[model samples]
Target: MQRYFIAPEQFGEHTVMIDGEDAHHLLKVMRMKAGDEIIVCDGLGKSARAKLTLLQAGQAEADITEWLGASAEPLWKVTVAQSLPKGDKLETVIQKGTEVGAAAFIPFQSDRSIVQYDGKKEEKRRQRWSKIAKEAAEQAHREIIPHIGEVHSWKQLLQRMAEFDLVLFCYEKEGGAAGSGIADAARSFHRSRGESQEASILLVVGPEGGFTSQEAEQALAGGAQLAGLGKRILRTETAALVGLTCLMYESNEMGGA
Candidate 1:
């Protein structure tokens, strides 16, 4: 059965309407017929199994055959507060980050970040990232789309770091510290959360050149524990995905995929 996300408002008693682009895809692209089965989700974790009752121009009606509760969301909520990288990097970050179940993405300008964003450019950046997140979520079969928060300065990032329960700032300083790295930090914190407990993880990854000493120290002072990804360095785009995958896998929450 095909799966599509719809707004909670569109879900009604016994009947549901899926119109617009989705309808067009179902009717034409996917060649869905009247009796075809489809699953509709609210993108906020509610879902229903429906059989197509009617198909028309910009409209596809169905009956609610069954309801699926919030069964698709990740057990851990992760927020990636990444330093703004060079051109096209942010798009990759948002798209892959969404696939890994990040709840939010924070783009910030750090000391080593060469890319500067003025007010106007910053708004456009957010919009583009938002689009990438939406498409990634749909393709990954995610029930909720991760939010792309506005670009921030180092000061603003520190101010917001206190919000998450466990905040981790990827720092090379941990390279010198024995037995304390990103993998270690992630396991140390994630292990404390019993299965089914509601917890949030905030992982901060810097730009192409990585975080400066001052920025890393400040992030630590602001409540984020510092950790190094590993001995071999990674690119800005690679670091986010690598670090996140390690975190999810270590926690056994990647769910066999």
Candidate 2:
């Protein structure tokens, strides 16, 4: 069955009127008939099977049917505070990170960051990134779209560390006893019961060149654990995915695959 996205408000009165772009896709591109069945996700926690009851130029309605599923979300809220990288990599980071169940993505201006945005440019960039996150969530069959937070200064990133229960910094520059082995740390974080140090995992990843010693030190001093992902260094985009994947594995979302 074909699947489309709609807001929760469209679900009352035993019918949902598919409007805007979704109606355009159904009528023009797909040429769907009145009896055709399609699934609509509310992007909250509800998905339903419905057949087209009416199809018109200005209106398209689907009749009520059985629900496909309910409540698809992760256990914890994982937010990624990443230093904005150059090029189109930010789009990829937002998309893939959404797929792995990251609850939020914050673009931070850091010392080593190459690209910079301010005022109007920053707002436009954020709008585009939010759209990418929405599309990724629907593609991945996620129940809710991950949030794209406003771009903040590196100092803001350091100050906000206290809000999250677990703050982990993936900085390869930091070495020694402060480090926690990847797999074991993930296991420990996953197994944490009630209110452990990792009840709310907030991961921090740097830009293309990685975090400077000063930035890493500041974050560590602000209660962020400088955890090593592996021996080799990864690009800004690759590092986000790696960190998100590690969080998923640690949170037991990998599902034995």
Candidate 3:
């Protein structure tokens, strides 16, 4: 079934009103009419099965049939704090990261980042990134769409480190060393959770040139654990996904073999 993320207010006692882009996609693009069943999510984790009762140009309505219980979200909320990379690599990260169970994304400027920050076009770029996340979430059957944060400077990103329960800094220098791996970190995080089932994690990936020693030291001082992906060096765009996948696997969000 096709899934659509609707606002909470748009949902009635047992009905949901789909409008604007979603409606157009359902009514015209998908050619969905009355009696077609679709899944509706609030993007805040609530979702339900609905049968379309009305379909018109730019508007559609569906009667809720069953509230979904299973969720595609990870037990721990993993936010990807990615440094600006060259070209459109950030877009690829956002799209694939969302599918890999990232709860949010924070794009920041690092010391060795090749792309310079452009404040004038940030909003437009953010909108495009958000759209990519949303589409990826829908395709992956995620209960919530991953959030895209505004571009942050190195200092700004460091200041927000305290917000997360754990921060894993992906540094190339840690490869093949005795440093912490994402699984061990995730396991430690899970053990320390005590009564809480949910925890927030910030996975920081550097740019193409990777994080400098000074930056890595600063991150360690800011309460981040330096971790490695594997023996092979990964592109800046691939690090976030790999780290996120490892975290998910360790948390048992990924199915057992």
Query: Against the unseen true structure, what C-alpha lDDT does each candidate score?
Result: 0.82, 0.80, 0.90
Candidate closer to the true structure by TM-score (higher is better), 2 or 3? 3
Record all residue pairs in model 1 with backbone atoms less than 3 Å apart, i.e. clashing. none
User: On residues 1-257, what C-alpha lDDT tens digit does candidate 3 reach at each position?
Assistant: 89998889999999999999999999788998899999999999999999999999889999999998967677789999999998899999999999889999999999998999989999999999999998898999999999999999999999999999999999877776653576667777777785338889999999998999999999999999998887899999888889989888777777622
Candidate 2 stretches with Cα past 4 Å from truth are 68-70, 174-179, 194-199
Lowest-sum lDDT 10-residue window in model 2:
174-183
What is the total number of backbone clashes in candidate 1?
0
Q: Give the residue spans of candidate 1 off by over 4 A.
A: 255-257
Better of 1 and 3 by lDDT: 3
Q: What is the TM-score of each candidate against the true structure?
A: 0.91, 0.88, 0.95
By TM-score, rank the candidates, best first: 3, 1, 2
Report each candidate's C-alpha RMSD, comma-separated, in the order given.
2.2, 2.8, 1.7
Write one digit per residue (lDDT tens) for candidate 2, span 1-257.
Answer: 66777889988757887898778888998899899998887877688889898887756899978876546577767898888888899899899999888888998988988988667788888889988987788778877778788998998988899998878888775432333645555566555554323366788888888888888789879998777777677888888888888777666667732
Judging by lDDT, tell me the better candidate of 1 and 2.
Answer: 1
Residue 177 alpha-carbon offset, candidate 2, angstroms = 8.4
Model 1 lDDT tens row, 21-43:
88998999999998899988877
The numbered model that scores best in lDDT is: 3
CA error at residue 202 for candidate 2, angstroms: 1.4
